[model samples]
Target: METSDKVIHAIYNDDDVLMAAVKTVKAKRFHIEEIYTPFPVHGLDKAMGLAPTRIAIAAFMYGCVGLTVATIMMNFIMIEDWPQNIGGKPSFSYLENMPAFVPIMFELTVFFAAHLMVITFYLRSRMWPFKKAENPDPRTTDDHFLMEIPVNHGNERELHDLLSKTGAVEINVVNNTH
Candidate 1:
């Protein structure tokens, strides 16, 4: 919980304005701490120049694990432990009965990929139970959008003026010592 004595919060009324402000701030070579919006804004990450996510690779690996488990379990149950005969057909070979296991494999693959991806996202975001909210302004959760910027010494006025020009509805300089 380190702190900064000079942090400015520039509040915006719309996402479009916020996006433009972000681009302007970046063009001016100012470091943006974070932005809070009530809803997801498309292309915001690209505007911020953040790297692409790798969640899809993780989901694929999880699906592979699920498929392997399903195949092994089905093979053992249908061909090894107790061989069952259906319609004068004996369950003696796993490869021959692979068609019957396709549905189970597909279901388990989807289930594992979905469940594990959700759990991974929650953990990665530090969204555990009973965690306190980190939003600085309550209004950001409802309708307002807040952009946080670190103010260097002697540049607070310039930053405020720039934010105002970028269509910020309100600006507050906060001592973020937390």
Candidate 2:
């Protein structure tokens, strides 16, 4: 992250060209700071050498917690706290009344997983409520694509040449404060 001092912002018109530029820069062992695309570019993570996400594991654990909560809550409400006998069916034991709790358990599990996963994604991406967005170029949100490569070891000239060769319509060397 110290390489954030100076960054070469390369703008490409097409996603295919941008992807090719990513591969070329990675092949040269140049570290890419980030890429801003109008849409999600498939295989970009692999091209950037990013590790596989652990969010799925977190979601699974959250789901388990939800399931456990539902089970314990239903058991307490139906059996331990107040044993209800409705239509000749007595909620005396949890296992005996498990079929009734299936809907609650399933709903809670899905609810926790979906909601918590979104929170985890936002937190991991450093996105917070009312925070100023860090978009360097507004065009990336529309039809253009922007790739940020931090200039390290004074490789600004080399990166500029490489980016120009990779079909970048615009390249700017900027002093990155953030």
Candidate 3:
């Protein structure tokens, strides 16, 4: 998103105001860039027309990768690199009866899936250590609801009127550039 574009936002005092604002915005066919609230609101994502996240897909892929790596590494280490007989057990074989390797494999799979999923989340969201968060209204973190509209074809006066009619207590035109 370019800094020069205009972003119109309305801050609602309560959830009733927020819910009404969302329905009105959707009814008007105006595109909402995003919304912020002190807490999750029911059906808010659906109102914004946002699709379900792909994090599950990412986690699954990472899990598969982890499992493959664990299996290959364990097989190589136990069967090929340093085969040894322990407790009169057979060497160079994945023991089906004992199942000693299953625990390690499971642990590695979980480790990789969790770590890689976190990394993927960080990268996808552009969230990094020491990076500034782009939260315009701090009140949204504490008892306020915010609705952001992409400034494309809508008139500022009309949008403001709509917000005010829907019980928005405060309306601000956020000039992203300056």
Candidate 4:
């Protein structure tokens, strides 16, 4: 992504005020670069007008793949490869003994859905083990919230004044060449 040459960082102390500021900024047609919060703010995405995520669809597909793998693995191990007779129950047909594989199938389905969903989230967020933090303000990691607005073409002064009116605790105009 191309980095912005200038940006404005507006700091808010409360999530409720931050959400209202987001709606106000959007109504004024200003492009919000990003927002950083110490904790997850409910309805922040809706305030920002972001589309709903598709992680649930991906999780369902992962669960289906896990079910298929478990079915094939159990059929090969218990019926085709090495048939065994335990407690007067013979592994002669997989269909006849499907009840014994239900638990394994369910467990594998849940396991794959959970693990793969986490991995998908990490990959989508560009987050991996040992990645350096990208937050601009240290206070945002604690009890503060930050809203970054890019200074598109020469709107620094206007954005600064507008954000200041929105009850920001602090406002900084940064030249983010790095």
Candidate 5:
């Protein structure tokens, strides 16, 4: 979102109130820049009109890659590269010994899916190393919820009234530093 110079910060004490405020603001056709909450609020993403994320698809693909890698590595190590003579099973054939590789394949799939999903989410969020925090108020990190909206030239009063009607505990208009 490309925020303007001036913005409105509406702080709410309750998550339910915050949710109502969000719906109210969107009903009034105001664009919400962001919302900061101490914890995740269920259904907040849907309420914000945010597009459903496709990260699960990425995770499944990554899991497939991991499974492939595990299969190839196990095949090369046990069958082709160095065939071991353990338990009278020196066939040097992957198909014959496929049962023994099940645990490895499962672990690799879970590992790749979980780790890569986290990295992908971090990168997709543009949250690289040493990035400045976007939280506008410290109270939001504690027990409050903060909603930020880009302020148009003549919408301050209207926005303020709207927030107050929606149970916002405090509101402020501030100019952005950057």
Candidate 6:
């Protein structure tokens, strides 16, 4: 669809003005494709009705997998492959004698969860190290609030008016050419 080349009408400037604009747009049930800002704005997610991220759940699942794998691997290697009794402790015992392995297990769990979660986030967000960053407006990263509205028939003028009323210091129509 040549999404990069698609025209985006943006409202730039103060965060408070952007917040009020977003509220107005959201209250009217207008679909906002995306919003860009220089810094994280508190409560913006809620105002946009974005659902809470599910990465935590995925991380927990990954950690559980890591824990299970570590436990089984250590038990098999230490008890079955090379059974050793340290300080006369029973080799077959897991809970009592395997306390030494707790650190390894915990580290593995955290490692797997963190790494896998990052990979998942990267894939899900369509981000890659070699790819060019999708910055709609470079100034937004400095000090601007950029709101992108998709081109739809019959809504351009109304959206522009709403953006103006929302106190947009500068509004520019851009074409995404990627």
Give Cα-based local distance difference scores for all models: 0.91, 0.90, 0.81, 0.92, 0.91, 0.81
TM-score of each: 0.91, 0.93, 0.84, 0.93, 0.94, 0.84
* Model 1 poorest ten-residue lDDT run: 1-10
Segments in model 3 whose C-alpha atoms lie over 4 Å from true places:
1-4, 95-98, 152-154
Q: What tens digits encode model 2's per-residue C-alpha lDDT throughout 1-178?
A: 4645788899999999988999999999988888999999999999999999898899999999899989999899889998979777767699988887899999999998899999999998899999898999999899999999888887889999999999999999889866
Candidate 1, residue 164: the lDDT equals 95
lDDT by residue (1-178, candidate 4, tens digit) is 4567988999999999999999999999988879999999999998888999999999999999999999999999999999988777768899988988999999999999999999999999999999998899999999999999888877888888899889999999887734
Ranked by TM-score, the better of candidates 4 and 6 is 4
* Each candidate: RMSD: 2.1, 1.5, 2.7, 1.8, 1.5, 2.8
Error of 1 at 91 (Å): 1.3
| Off by more than 4 A, model 4 | 1-3
Which digits, one per residue and each the tens of the lDDT, describe model 6 over residues 31-71? Answer: 77788899999988889999998999999999998899899
Clashing residue pairs in all predictions, respectively, total 0, 0, 0, 0, 0, 5
The better-scoring model by lDDT among 2 and 6 is: 2
The number of clashing residue pairs in model 5 is 0
lDDT of 1 at 149: 89
Clashing pairs in 4: none
- Give the TM-score comparing model 5 with the true structure, all chains together: 0.94
| Residue 112 in candidate 2, Cα distance off native in Å | 0.9
TM-score of 6: 0.84
For model 2, the local distance difference test gives 0.90
Candidate 3 residue 79 Cα shift, in angstroms, is 2.2
User: Lowest summed-lDDT stretch of 10 residues in model 4?
Assistant: 1-10
